[model samples]
Target: MDRLLSIEPLSAAAFAPFGEVIAAGAALQRFAINGGTTERLHALARARADDGDVVISLALAQARQFPFEISMLERHPKGSQAFIPLDQRPYIIVVASAPTHQPHAFLATQGEGINFRAGTWHHPLIALQDSSQFLIVDRDGPGNNCDEIALQPSWWLTGIDAG
Candidate 1:
C-alpha cells in the first residue's frame, strides 16, 4: 500500500495533461446569495454537484464528533466523473500516474478539492480527523460505476499532513 501524503494546492496547470483542470471556484456559476439579489458564484469543480441540471446537497462531520470507518475504495472505469464536497473541514487524496514519471500522491486541504478522471486510482471515502460527509456525484448508471480495488486491509490514508 502507498503511504498517504498532505493535500497541496498546485496550479491547475499541473493536472492538465491527464484531463481538464477545472477549479471548483471557477466552474460554478452562482445564481443566488444573501436575499433576493443574485449573482454568479463559481465554486470548486469537485464541490459542485450536478445531475444533468440538478444541484444536489452535500454535508460534513467532524472527527471526534462522529466515529466512523471507511471499509472500501472504489473506482470508475467508464468516462465517469465525481464531485465530492468537503462539507466539513477535511482533506482529499488523489492517486495519479504521470506519463513519464512515477505515480504521484496528492492531498488536498479542506479548502482544496479534486476532480478524478474515470479509471484513476483512488481511495474510498477518506476522512481526516473528521466524519467528512460529501455530496458525492458520480455515475449512478447501468454498469458498475464503483469499482473496488481490494488492497491490503490496511491501505488507508487517515489524516491530513500536507506540508
Candidate 2:
C-alpha cells in the first residue's frame, strides 16, 4: 500500500536537520565585493568529502510525474551532495533522518538549492520542468560512496501544485 507524503516549502529552519538551504537574501550573510560591482553571499553551504576530491558537475534531470512514488532513498556515506538548479525551475527534495527514516518532502523554488549532509537519506532529483538542468557538487573518485535502501511501505509524494 502506498502512503501519502506532503511537500512543504523549503526553508533554512525546516531543512536544518537534513541539510543546509542554499539561497541568498537579507536573511543570510552578505557583503559587497569587486569594488561594489558584486554582492556575495558567504558560505551558503560547504561541500564536504571524507576522502575523495570534491568536484562540480552538471546533471540533466528529466521531469518527474506528479504523485510520484518514492520506493527507495540513497545516501552518500563519505561525502555531501548539493544540487543547484540551472534552469530556474522548481523541484522537489525528499529526505529522511536516520533510525526511523520517516520521509519528508520539500519544494525548492526558483533560485534556491540544497546541500544534503553526508549520510542523509534522500530521493533523487525530482525536477518539475522537462529537461531541467542542475549544477551538482560532490565527491569524485573513491570507495562506494553511495548506498540505497528500499522503503517497505512506499510513499506517494503530493502537493506540487501548492508548491
Candidate 3:
C-alpha cells in the first residue's frame, strides 16, 4: 500500500548492490572558487555515531537563490548509502535502496551534475537545474543513523531525455 517509483540513471552496473556513485573531485566544504578559496570535494562515505550527540549542516547551495531543502537524514542499521547533488555545475546523483524492489519512480539530471549512494531513497532538495553545490555526510552522534519516511503518495523524478 506504498509503492511509487521514478528515479533512475545510476551506473556502476546500475549501482552495484547500491553503493559507490563517485565524482565531486575538488571544491567542497561550502564550495568556493574565484576569490574565496575553499576546496576539498569528493566524499561519499564517512560516518561516525556510537552516540555522543551529533547534528551538523553546512551550506553553500545557491541556484535560484536558496530554495533547496532536505531535512537531515542518516541511516545504516547495517545498511547505509547516499551521494547527493543535482546542480552546482558539476553533475552527480546516486541514491541507493533496492535489494528486492521498492523503486517505482525517481529521476535525476539537469545541470550541476548529480551524486547519491548512501541509504539512497531520495526526494529531498532535488534541484533540476541551476542551483546546487552541496556537501552533506550523515551519521554523527546520539544513536545516529537517522530515519524518516514521510511520503504521501506523491513521488516523481522520471528519466530525463531517456538517455
Candidate 4:
C-alpha cells in the first residue's frame, strides 16, 4: 500500500530543517533601493555551490495532476537549488530528510519561493498550472552533482485541490 502524504502550508519555521524559505515579509530585512523605488528583501536565501560556480537558468514545467505519485527524489550533493516562480502560480514541494527519508509536502503559494540546502532530497518541480515558468539558480559545473533514489512502494500525495 502506498503511503499518504499530508500537504501543509509553506512557512519558514516549518521548512527550516530542509532549507530556507524565499519570500518577502515584514519580518525579513528590507531596504529601499533604486532611488527609493524598489523595496529589496535582502538575502532571503543564499545559494551554495561546493565545487563549481552558481548559475541561473529558466525552466518550463508541465502541470502535474494530483494524488501525484512520488516515486523518486533527487538531491544536489555539491550545491543548493532554488526555484522562483515566474508566473506567480501555486505549486507543490515534496522533500525528505536523511536516514529515514520520510517525505513531507508543502504548498507554495504565490510570492513564495524556496531554496533547498545542499544534499536535501526533493522531488522535481510540481507545477499546478500548465506551462509554468520558473527561474532556477544552482551550480553549473562538473562532477555529477545530482543524486537520485527510487522510493519503494511510492507515496501518494493527495489532499490538495489544484483548482
**What TM-scores do the predictions have?**
0.55, 0.94, 0.25, 0.94
Tens-digit lDDT track for model 2 on 1-163?
8689887889999999988988874147788999999988898998999988999999998888877899999999899999999867889999999525679999998769999999999998889887888999999877999999888888898657623
Candidate 4's displacement at residue 146, Å, is: 0.5
Tens digits of per-residue lDDT, candidate 1, 1-163, equal 4533334553456654333334444454657676858664454443222232223546563443222223335556654355454453445454544222233334444454556666665555455555566665454445555566543433333443422
- The ten-residue window of minimal lDDT in model 3 covers 64-73
Total backbone collisions for each predicted model: 12, 0, 37, 0
For model 4 the TM-score comes to 0.94
Q: Return the lDDT, model 2, position 50.
A: 93
Misplaced by over 4 Å in model 3 are 1-50, 59-75, 78-98, 104-126, 133-138, 141-163
lDDT of 3: 0.40
Q: How accurate is candidate 4 locally (lDDT)?
A: 0.88
Model 2 CA deviation exceeding 4 Å by range = none
Put down candidate 4 lDDT per residue, 9-105, tens digits, no spaces: 9999999989998888513788899999998889989899987999999999998987789999999999999998888888999999962567999
Query: How well is each residue in 1-163 modelled by candidate 3, as lDDT tens digits?
Result: 3243445554434654544444443223345565767554535344433434333444355332222223222335423433345332433242436323343223434322233334555444443445455555444544435455544443333334322
Candidates ranked, most accurate by TM-score first: 4, 2, 1, 3
The global C-alpha lDDT for each of the candidates, from Candidate 1 onward, is 0.47, 0.87, 0.40, 0.88
Screening candidate 4 with a backbone cut-off below 3 angstroms (N, C-alpha, C), the clashing residue pairs are none
Give RMSD (Å) of candidate 2 vs. truth.
Answer: 1.7
